[model samples]
Each structure stands twice: as structure tokens, then as C-alpha cells.
Target: MMTIKNSPASQPMLSMTGFAATESRFTGGLLLIELRAVNHRYLELNVKIDDNLRQFEAQVRELLQSRLGRGKVECRINLKSDAAVANLTLNPEMVGQIAQTLAALQQHFPQAQPVNLVEVLKLPGVCQTESIDTEAMAQSLLNGLSQAIDELIAARQREGEKLKQVLLDRLQGVREQISIVKPLLPALISQYQDKLTTKLREAMQAEDDRVRQEIVLYAQRIDVDEELARLNAHIVEMDRILTAGGTMGKKLDFLMQEMNREANTLGSKSVAIETTQVSMQLKVLIEQMREQIQNIE
Candidate 1:
């Protein structure tokens, strides 16, 4: 039967970067497994192993692909033999063949130096090292890898929780800035209307229909009601996405872009210094959230 490790049930948000390592010792050698991951748009597995364990590379790749959905992941394996336990075994068939060939050569040319046992043993394929059970070793290495992956996931989850809190705090900051600007809009518009009315009375010395039309047109041009409405809607959508959490990085990123656009429009249309400051604050908060979102998975 094959054993497999399962991830935690309540999957919190995950960050794309983490590190973990595990080591195991057996009678023949020691095995060390290390896993490192960083943010990436898609899953990319890079496995490195000693030449002796090259045969296990495919299994390692399959295991990583199954466990991870997104990231640039690198898996490194190191195996070391215990000097006290290491031993060499001769291949009888190979040694016999080499001996026969050497004998034939000696008969043909008696002056040829007779090959000693040590030199024959040193020849290629003549001596075989004490062998490890490949299947058993592979299984042990896989088990160690599974443990390392589990640790990596836990680390990412912890970091992700921190990210979530930071995002929520920034979201609240955005809401507060919106609140500060909302009440100022109506008063700002009223002040502008009063000023225009007084200017027309002083300059024209009579109530003119054209002046009224000009005031209305100027008010419309500076109105930011549409931008404010869109900003509120984007904020609501972002809250929903964050609450419903699962691979929300891209969605949150798009929502940030929308929010920034609205803020820019609001700033451009602002007739009051208070409104301009609020717009700047909103943009700064959105930018901070965006920077954190890039690390989220």
C-alpha cells in the first residue's frame, strides 16, 4: 500500500513563497529533502538530485505537481553514504571475462605485463558498489518530501493570514477616506453656486438667463457623483471577493485597478482642497493593497 500526506482541511489563503526541509537516515545512507517556493503565475517544478538517484526524478516531479497548484518550486535531494557501512562487491561475470581476455593477450605476447587483481578490479564495470534497494529508498525520499511540503504550506498560510489582515486594514482606510469626502461634496457644490451667483450679479448689474446656464454647465463639469458611486461599488465588490477567499489575487488586483481609476477621476473633478486630499489618500491605500496582493496566491 502507498502512503500519502493530506493537506489541512480549512484551506486559508496561501502566500506564494515558503521554505521547508526534512532529513532521514537509513542503514545504507542519509537522505535530505529541501523545498523552496516563490510567487509565479503557474506551477513550475525544478528537481535536482545526485546522479545515483536520477531514476527517482520523475516520481519527485509527479509528487510536487500533485501537491502544488501555483508557484516556482525547486526540490533538492542529497544522499550521503556512511563511511563505516560502505562496501564494494565484485561482479563475478565481468571479472571472469576480463581475466580471460588478459590471459589470451599474455599467450599472444609473453612480454606484455600481467594485469594484477587490484588493477583488474579498478577497471570499468569490474567492481560493483554495495547496492541500495531503489524502491525502498525512493519511497523513503518521497515520504520526506511530503513532510517538507506540509511545512511549506503551513508557513505560507501563516504569512497569508498576515496579508489578509493588512488588506482589510487598508480597505477600512479607503472607506474612511470616502466617508470624509462624501459630505464635503454637497457643501462644495453649494459654495460654488453661491459664488457664481454673486459674481453674475456684480458683473452684469442684472439677472441674466445666460449666466444661469453658464453656472449649471460649470457645476455639471465639476460633479463627481458618478465617480463616487463607482468607487463605492468597487469597494463593495472587493470586500466580497476578500470574504469569499480562494485564489483571489487576480480578482483583487483587477478591483484595485478599478478603484484607482475612480480615485483619479475624483481627483481631476475636485473643486475643493479637502476632496483632493481624500482622493490622494485613496490612491495611496489602493497602491499598498496592490503591493501585498502580488505575494498572495
Candidate 2:
């Protein structure tokens, strides 16, 4: 009846990468279990164990998949038997055959040294050790795994908290850039209209209604109000997701893509040096958040 500890009211985020290990000693052997995880598009599990513990593979995979949502997880089990449990026992038939062969060799070469007990035992198939209790070993390994998962989750949570703060800071920077760009829009449009009118008058040597229509069309092309509004909305959504925690890597990644799209549009439509600078800064912040979000879970 093992259960994961409940998350606190202020839920912290979780990173996909972490490490944990646990060990248990039984009457016959020592069992060591280690878990390592890193970011992946989906849950990918790999387990390694000594032949004696191979029977527990399904159970271990089930336990890991139930606990983790997304990551490339690697599980390793090392079993070391005690001296008493590993003590070799003679295979009577194999030992008898080896003894007969050694006697034949001694008769052929009288000067050869007599075969010792150690030499006979060293011969393949002459000695063996008893098998371990697979059922008992599986139980012990699972118990150790339960504790290891708990520690791994804790480590991920700690790293996630730091990632959350970094994203939030970048989000705030995006907001600041949006604000800066918003004020410059009106002035940019006015300057473009004035410049267009002057150029048209100089080229045509007279006022023309067609010149005014062209200015309007050019102004509309550079208007970034829609992009700014969408950028602001994306920032709000990102903040909400971070606050609500748990398996947010994919969601955050999508949001970064949306934010980057808006930033790109803003840069392309820039009419002034200040607007271009703000767009560049916004892109830099979004890129930073995107990189960090890749490691979140």
C-alpha cells in the first residue's frame, strides 16, 4: 500500500531529469537499485539486472511508468551474494570425470604434478552455486525502489522551482518590452504619414488624393497592435500554467512557440529603431524561456 506523498497547496513544478538510488541487504545477498531520468518526448524505460533478478522486469517497469509521465528513465540493479551463499558445491559426476582424466594424464607423464583440489574446482562445470530466491529478491528490490522514487521526485521539484522563477522573470521582461513598444506605435504611424506626404508632394509637385490612400495602406501594414495583444495574452497564460504546476513541459513549450511567432511578426513590422530593439529583446527573453522549458515536466 505504498503511496506518493501529496503535493503541497503551493504546488512546485517538476523537472524531467533526476537521479536516485536505494539498497537493501537480505540473508543471502545485497540488492542495489539506481534510477536516472532525462527529458524525452514520451515515457521511455530501460532496465538492467542480473539474470537472477530478470523475472522482476515487468513489475519494475510497471512501477516506474505509473510514477513518471515523461522521460527516458534508466533502472539498474546490482546484486552481490554473501560468501556463504556463493560457496561452491562439487558437481559429483563432473568431478568424477575430471578425476579420471587427471589420473590418465599422470600415468602418461609420471613427472607431472598431481592435480590438487583447487585445480579440479577451477575446471568448468566441476563446481556450482545454488540459485537465489527470485520472489523474495523482487519484493526487496521493489521496496527499495519506492523510497528511491520519492527522493527522485523531490530532486526534480527542487530544480523545477528554480526553472519556474527564471521563466517568470523572462515573462516579466516580455511584458516590459510590450509596454515600451505600445507607446511607440502611435508616434511611428504619425511619422510615416508625415514622411509619405512630403515625399509624394515633392515627387508629383502637387497634392493628390491617391497619395493619401497609399499612406493609409502603408500604415496599416506596419500596425502591430494585434501582435502585441496576442503576446500579452500568451504571457498571462504562461504565468497561469507555471502557478498551476505538474507535467507542464509540453504546454510551456507550445506557449513559447506562440510567443516567438508574435515576436517575429513584431520585428518584421518594425518602423523605428526603438521598436526593432524592443522586438529583439522580446525574442531573446522568449528564447531563454524556451530553452529552460525543454527540461521541465
Per-model TM-score versus the true fold: 0.82, 0.86
The numbered model that scores best in lDDT is 2
- Candidate 2, superposed: residue stretches over 4 Å from native: 1-11, 84-88, 101-131, 205-212
Residue range 29-79, candidate 1, lDDT tens digits: 889889999988888888989777898898889888888778899899999
Clash count per candidate? 0, 0
Candidate 1 TM-score to native: 0.82
The weakest ten consecutive residues by lDDT in model 1 span 6-15
In model 1, the runs with Cα more than 4 Å from the true position are: 1-10, 89-127, 206-212
lDDT of 1 at 207: 70
